[model samples]
Target: MMQRRTLAAGVAAFSALWLAAPLATAAVETPDALVKRLSADILETIKADPELRNGNIARISQVVDNTVMPHVNFRRMTSAAVGPQWRQATPAQRERLQQEFKLMLIRTYAGALKQVSDQRVVVKPLRAAPEDKDVLVRTEVHGKGEPVQLDFRLENTDGKGWKIYNLNVLGVWMVETYRTQFAQELNKGGIDGLINALASRTIAADAKTAKSAQP
Candidate 1:
């Protein structure tokens, strides 16, 4: 409860992390180990950098690009959010959707990475078979109040290490939530409509970020 509000207000964005993994070569990073290390690194990076703590949009974008984007499985995340319409989308549209969605998240949460002073991530032991390719890792974010539950759904490729495609916070899965909204937009107009909606939100968020940055 308070953790969500605190994070949404301050912004660690485990929500964004669910969407934050991409192509990886052969690595032996286990899901829980990755979460523990990634979480620690992110917190340290934010607290150590003054500009990031101050919420400079440009700096935040740079950090996200260099640090987080590499680990995100963008296609799996975007396509799942787009639902069945994903297969119908052309390559260009798919690219646009992914771009806008990326911006929406960066603009929404990445910029606030600085306010993570008290939040500490505790990843629970992962439960899965040795042969499993897809698995969930449970975690908690401890802050001002009761610890909030966070979960990650990760998939592994033969050569690639674990990549996160979805995230859950406070009992809500981000993809499932976005899918419903995207479906509504799809019904109203189509893929274009959904893209437009995401674009509009991203644009508005950009404007808000700019204004905030203005001192």
Candidate 2:
């Protein structure tokens, strides 16, 4: 369990790097190119900004908002994570879950980003066809010993460009992992119960943050 959590944390940390790459010159592209562009951009920003190297929460939040969220399809991710429950959810419940799930990820990822230090990413080229709308960009994150494989799955949008819908770390899909946990919670507590649980967790995290800020 600890190993799984660590892998997930690593994925969250790499997510910011996964979004900063430049797309291919071809009119049609693959996931590998997108991941490369996103990761490069993220590294560039951190390299240029010495303060962000410290992993301050505020700075991490800024990077997430500016460089991460814009390219992530949270709604789609949420739906996929929820699995079958997603189809059963009413529109309102779906919306609430989507919002809560996005917040949960942002908060979770923000916390993980604070743990990122001087880590270098090694991009491994993968074969992707032009017609492949959904592709996973595979890379190994090196530093602090034992490189871990990170994969970002992206889908091309009609006009908004490429957006990330899933991430795989060490052969585990982050959203899917959470979905299983969430589904168990829902089964036991129902949709409202799940929402309340997520809210409580967020509130608790916030309180912990506030307490840590004290002198």
Q: Across residues 1-215, which tens digit of lDDT does each residue of candidate 1 receive? A: 66547546334647334223333436678878887777766666666777776766677677667767656687899999899999999999999999888878766665556546767888898898888889999988877766777888988876467777888877889899889889999999898998999999988987876777676
Candidate 1 off by > 4 Å: 1-27, 111-114, 213-215
In terms of lDDT, model 1 sits at 0.75
Clash list (residue pairs), candidate 2: 17-39, 19-38, 20-37, 20-38, 21-37, 21-38, 22-37
Each prediction's number of clashing residue pairs: 7, 7
| Model 2 Cα lDDT, one tens digit per residue, 1-215 | 65755574466456456335343455544556666666656766666765565445566566566656666887898888877777878899988887677556656655455445565667787767766666677787765656777878888867446788887788888887988888888898877777777887778877877787789
Runs in model 2 lying further than 4 Å from the true structure: 1-9, 18-29, 47-66, 157-160
Model 2's number of clashes is 7
Top lDDT hit: 1
